[model samples]
Target: MTTATTGDTTPTPRSRLLPQGVGVIADVAAVAALLAGGGRPIVWAGSLGAVLAGSYLLVRRLGQPVDRTAVVGLVVAVVGAGIFGYALRPSPPAGPAQQTTATPHSTDPTAGSPTPGATTNSTAPGATAGSPTPGASAADTPAETWLADVAAVDGGEGWRHGAATVAGTEHPRSVIGSTCSSTHDGHESFNLARRYSRFRSTIGMPDDAPNDAHTRFRVLVDRKVLFQQDLRLGQTATVDVGVRNGLRLTLEVDSIGTTSCGDTAVWGGAVLRR
Candidate 1:
């Protein structure tokens, strides 16, 4: 009686999981095949590895035990991807081209010019005696230099007009012994030497009249006025009217009507060094 009847029982849950395992294997193979055709080899490897690990997880979800080796492989793949992402980044661009150096010009053998970097400021070094001061004007021009250098005083410029020669005229009317007449109250008379000169001279007021009649000369060097005498008629005296530098040398001479002061009577001059 106890020997009983033959009975059938349901299989364990794990027995049913074999089909999911097969499905996971198919999914992993499909993912791997797709990744294998990717353009980049590194991307293909990473994607294939990830898909395999995902298949293993799916197998474990379907009641199969997870393999520790598969978890380690997935971790290693992730680390490798991070390293690749860091190392394979694009670098900065190549810069512009470098500049080319210029070649020196060939020298002429017959020329007397010195070679480059050979000519110095002065002939000798450590020669402080002949060194020039910082603010020195052309204050020491020799006689030969002075005679060689000449320039036009003023032409179509400033208050004075008409051409006034620097060299004294033949038998200049105003000299050491000459008798000159001061026609107006403010008339400038000048003394002449063997080498007498005038920088500027005028016989009449400017065309702009009294406003522009005064001449302004910026005295650079300390100057001496040889003599300024008021000679009306048959009157004469010797005097020294010296002027210092930086001072404005103004010669404001009055006029005797429109056509009175001849060129010879009114004279103005400056002595400058180059």
Candidate 2:
């Protein structure tokens, strides 16, 4: 008697594709859905579920004529597999970080410290509002410091009394000079007070001194130009500048004399509110 040995064979490529077609379709559809309108998080979730179900259905069809019990078991297995795959995908990129740094500040009027971008100060009582804190660098002071310094000066037009030394101008003057100040006068509900100066050419012969006979002036705040004008002999003009909540101000006397002469200038003292 002769005996023959037999064993079950694995699925051929064509046979395997038949059972996996639904899964392939599901994966394609899911990716397409993501590419099209998956920006909303819910879309990804729903698509994943649908795709996994389709995969299971394709597999079940290959084993058709199964009993109810087998169908139930297949459904359970598909659900478990889908959940595992979803949990395993790599997470998306994170969003930009938010600013969490708290600003440092001092409370004394004269107790301010200079920081990179802005001045840090606290409005503590009786802190010598006019004096700049030790931390203030000549260059790093804020606009309010300029305003306060200007107010302390003896110019008729407040901080605007500095002289302008612009070249080529016949009557250059320092209306406010180089000063800093702050003010709260003539202000409405809004913080709209101004600190400015009025300068006239020195009323003497062109003594070869600065502003001997020049006739021009400029107004500035924090080194920012607010107004500039050329003056005629014996003529007087005025400018009105607007200030916000802060009193920081800057007034400067730019290069003076005609273009032929090299630039020469003078700056003034600090001014604050009256």
Candidate 3:
């Protein structure tokens, strides 16, 4: 005659540290964008929403009222959820099945074997009976190579993001430039008059600063002023620019070479050929 059991105690609501303060500012802006060099993939996915809002505020503060920096930000949200569970782990599972190595032929063609169409388009080494196949010439036919090397094209100087590739020094293509700005003068305006006016290279400080500091290399076409110079530090100035037909070219460098982001202007070997 006894049937009345209902122990319904219930009590679990507490989780709101505002997702542990937005997952500790998205895990410190994804560890400062992974120490600066990585792009912010939405701040590394906000460090997994700050480790699921610090595991729902550490299970609503287990024994209650927590705060030693909220238990060191819930141990940096469980070490950023085990380092994003091994940095987003996943790959490895497509196609993958390639391993080949097979070679062993000798069907005894008359023992010393030597008669499969007698092999000969007169293969090299003094190719007899009339030689001269090494590229068979229009005189080897390959000479107009520098058709364009302006920082390798598309309006070159690497579209300027602090453009600087003065390699082996003494700048040639060694200069694609920018100096951030300071009244201005680091230029590169383009358009070599299409009809293909020549343009070798060299303009300022590189070939290892043969000179440094005077900065003032100019050149204009449609607007007139052909080529101007003033380089100095260690000295550099061999930009042979030639123009003829319907054109428009202007290149100036003079952010002044010292400050104003050290302009150092370049075009060192910025070619444009026939």
Candidate 4:
């Protein structure tokens, strides 16, 4: 007589791996939903709960046994998901009740009136006319009159008005005068007619000028020189002269060297103030 052979009853590796793979996919989906919906607690919680419940039902329908360890793990996962979802909930918006309430002042008849010794206007004490007042708006302040904006009544051929760069500084409103060997001197005169009381400008040679280039700059009131300076390629000077009661305002530039190579002078930020 021959012995009867029996089929193997042990579970295969693939059978175990299939269930584990399904569980892992479900877990990844839950975590993704939680992270993606961090600001929406309801979306995160609902998605995670639905995925876990579906996974459990699917496993049960596949004839998988529900053990004590699996049941404990499922409970732990749900509790942890709830805690994280609650923690990641968005904060409530601020309402009118949460706003800061200012304290009410006493109901006195003279409460809003100006006190004695208090200054009403924005200008400070002893502030002169045409001067910039403290805390004054742009409308209240006097507008600047740039000399470059005005047409010169008498100007040399080399005189130019517009934007220019001097000593590596930019001047949006400027007047430039050039002096060469053919013309040793350049001048530009504006008819102020005694309207302006102060004149301000920065005098310097153009940055593109030769290193040895030297020139003399002069500011004159009614043909009288009020300010003068000799400047080199990189030298600069500030001209703040009083042109009070002056009829004519003139700017002159003269080449100091015999060659006068690159003797380009610039009057940067030239303005007349009243």
Identify the candidate with maximal TM-score. Answer: 4
How does each model score on lDDT? 0.32, 0.39, 0.52, 0.69
Candidate 4: give the clashing pairs: none
Provide the RMSD of all predictions against the true structure, rounded to 1 decimal. Answer: 16.5, 17.2, 28.5, 18.1
Report the backbone clash tally of model 4.
Answer: 0
Question: Model 2, residue 119: what's the lDDT?
Answer: 41
Better of 1 and 3 by TM-score: 1
lDDT of 3 by residue, 83-155 (tens): 5664566743656455444645555756676556343332321122221223343332122222222221123
Candidate 1: pairs in clash: 225-241, 225-242
Tens-digit per-residue lDDT, 43-77, candidate 4: 45654664465455445545557664355445545
TM-score of 3: 0.20
- Best model per lDDT: 4
TM-score of 2: 0.25
Clashes of each: 2, 55, 19, 0
Residue-level lDDT of model 2, residues 1-274, one tens digit each, is 8888677677654444333444544554454455444454554554565555555654656667765434543554455355446545686666556545676565567865654565434332223344444444434333333222223322333223333433233432232231111321111011113321221123211223434334345554444566565543233444445433333343333323443232222332222321
